[model samples]
Target: MDTPLINALEALKKENRISFHTPGHKKGRAYESMDDGGIQENLYQYDTTEVFGTDQLQDPTGAIKESQQWTARVFQSPEAYYLVNGSSAGVLAMILSQTKPGDEILLPRDVHQSVIHALILGDLTPRFIQPEIDPQFKIPKGITLPQVQEGLEKYPKCKGVLLTHPNYYGRPGEIREIRRMTREFGKILWVDQAHGAHLGLHPQLPLSGIDAGADLTVTSFHKTLPAMTQSAVLFAGGEVVDRERLLEQLNMHQSSSPSYILLASIEQGTRHYAKAGKEKMQVLLEAIESFEQKFRRLGLFQLDTAPGKDRTKIWIHTENSGRTGHEVETYLRENHGIDMEFSMPQGLLALTSIGNREKDLKKLYLAFEELEETLYNKVKMEKFSEKYSKEAKEGFFEKEVERDKKEPLGLPIRTAFYSRKERVSINKSVNRVAGSAVTPYPPGIPLILPGEAITRGHRDQLLEYEKRNIKVIGIKAGKIMVVAEE
Candidate 1:
């Protein structure tokens, strides 16, 4: 049979690779303990449209509404809605419902690409608050109270604020404080908690956005919960959100025919969360702690840590060992049959969930132990030092420091996005208006946004990413899309 994707997936399944990645069911093992009423066993049979028994997702009145109500109760939100289109639709709805066209909204510059799409679709202007960067990981953390205070004070007439809690690397910021500030200023607070569905499941984890008093919050069930892909939930609470307007945007952004299978999986996932999430989370955390303690005893590995970082997400750094994360990731896959969530220049990330078992952590620890033992006797790898020079490293971090200073926007996001564009080399496009966003996937934060004026710093950082062979979305054959001049 000429089934390329299915064949590959089946082959990989046969390989029994250890997963520290998403679609958080760990290859459907979570379903084994779930009380799914045969939904997991007969997924094909359950695939159907809105019929007599099935209620409409947009205007839920029957079973769907009941399910969502149960979910809201479980998550401690005032009202909850299921989304088959993932958190992207929920993010768009949040923006469109809160503000009108040409109105300005305050948000972090490190927002997911969906936030930029919302700006384009709503014909709105953005007042970006730069997020603080982690000095060790070189990844953006979360918005601070001072940054938000400055943005709101500078753009006093801005409609509201949108924030991404636990920004991709699992470090949460001051959502509680920011929520209070927004209320005092009579502004709405919307949270993109796409990677924090497991929060509040355990006492040790950081507070969930809903619990932090966000007026609106969107969480992806698939990211850290035992839900199928594209399954998510949006919560509406507090006094700021316009309920009627939010419902309108929900319908506008979501599909007319939502997936029944996805809905079933969400319901089943929610059931698991309600039943066994805490117990299993405790087990998973203990396992991870044991793995960390064991690996740290090896005396040759480094683990990334922050004050409020999620313990479920582990980052293994090879900088001290003189190997790039990309190199270590390749070695793991080829030698240890393990897959990670993502790899950066500094380290590889492993996203754990309730679905992960103790054995999984044991496997990871064994792999790292073997890697260190095997490489300890050999001469130190010079590729990292040769490739990343001291001057280049300084420039890379210098670009991050420069992000604290606001760059000029050449045109409004909506106008620049719809305008005609021409392809130009990355270096030649500096100071010209960007026609599209240059974003890296996995973390999905845009380095350059549409309608923003390109700077020499942007050019140098992107060039460095290219030299490191990172995958960026907007560049093709070394050319970038810039708005054509008259």
Candidate 2:
């Protein structure tokens, strides 16, 4: 029987698009020279149900145990668990394992959507700590030590501090300093190191979460390593995180019938990292540096960078290309046959990994060159400030929560998410307690949480997002559904 997913993937291949995007493998062609000897095929063979030798993921005792042990060693962590559900699972697990209901946790405003869901799931109050945003590119940067200190001073009762190291844009924060602050404040340091999975493998790269004093760190192995999609790892460090509690939470959040294919991919990817990752990543870095030199010469786009950020993930914003990220993404895919990892309103990003080769980099350079010529000759440069500007000057990172006298429209997210609920419009949602969390997708943090009073600022942001076709969850009729008074 033919599967729809498989058929669709085949159709995509038929389209012959050049993948500048993900799996970091780029159509599985870039890593062909690696001495896999078809070990990847062997891995596929073992992707079976939990048999006699294959152990269950939740209670690993056999091959899974060995794999997890190997992974721990690879990352230099006290222990590591292969997460079949992606880094999102590991993040949620950390939150659930560490905090209790009504407890406060310090979270960076620029964190992924998963963290917001985790906060709602755990019934924890988030003390939002803003990240530093580059004035030029409007890209969010890492939080500073002073900011962490101030947050800890203000919210001393916070149970933990959740930070994203090497944020989605590839800006690496000073993790060591942040970790020190968290420890001094007697709070756990939970790092979302989704983009830094390859850090430990390369000595020249920025430090990994495990090495930088993070208590519990989650990495999306699939993002930067040669792992299958949805494969991730959660590393436990120091005495901050209770390992047993983490294991229990992981079992709860992770799937019982875990995919052995994804597990084996992690195993193989870790082994690859242990053996040849350094040399491979070195070559990858060299290729990127070379590409940057050529990219600067073209001069149609400005590549955003921050001090101490990992150089592998290159984020490009057009200077006068007069195109939204959507338009540039379309131009690459339709005209140049190239696809990138993500195209936000501000810029387009290309994630380079050990999986990339000289030829792959060359192809990207050629595409950019063509893109420059096409935009210069055919497209009139459109100023994007008016189109992409934030709805309110209320800083994305620095916004403060104000308590309103309005009654809640719905129960807290913890209850509303698990309960049967219906959608409502934004205007009608004013007095009701929110039944769900409504957030912006790219940096998926909730603008409105369940049980929080809906302010006009929140409404305006949602409306602006709607105008731009940005989707918001837990709402109906341009309003959000909330718990009604019985």
For TM-score, the strongest prediction is 1
Task: Report how far residue 439 has shifted in candidate 2, in Å.
Answer: 4.1
| lDDT over C-alpha atoms for residue 106 of model 2 | 82
Per-residue lDDT tens digits for candidate 1, residues 179-202, read 889999999888999989889888
Candidate 1, after superposition: displacement of residue 459 in Å? 2.5
Measured against the true structure, the TM-scores of the candidates, in listed sequence, are: 0.93, 0.86
In model 1, the worst 10-residue window by lDDT is: 380-389
List candidate 1 segments past 4 Å from native: 35-37, 298-300, 379-406
- Model 2 segments more than 4 A misplaced: 1-4, 35-44, 379-422, 425-434, 439-448, 451-486
lDDT of 2 by residue, 317-341 (tens): 7534545565677667766677787
lDDT of candidate model 2 versus the reference: 0.75
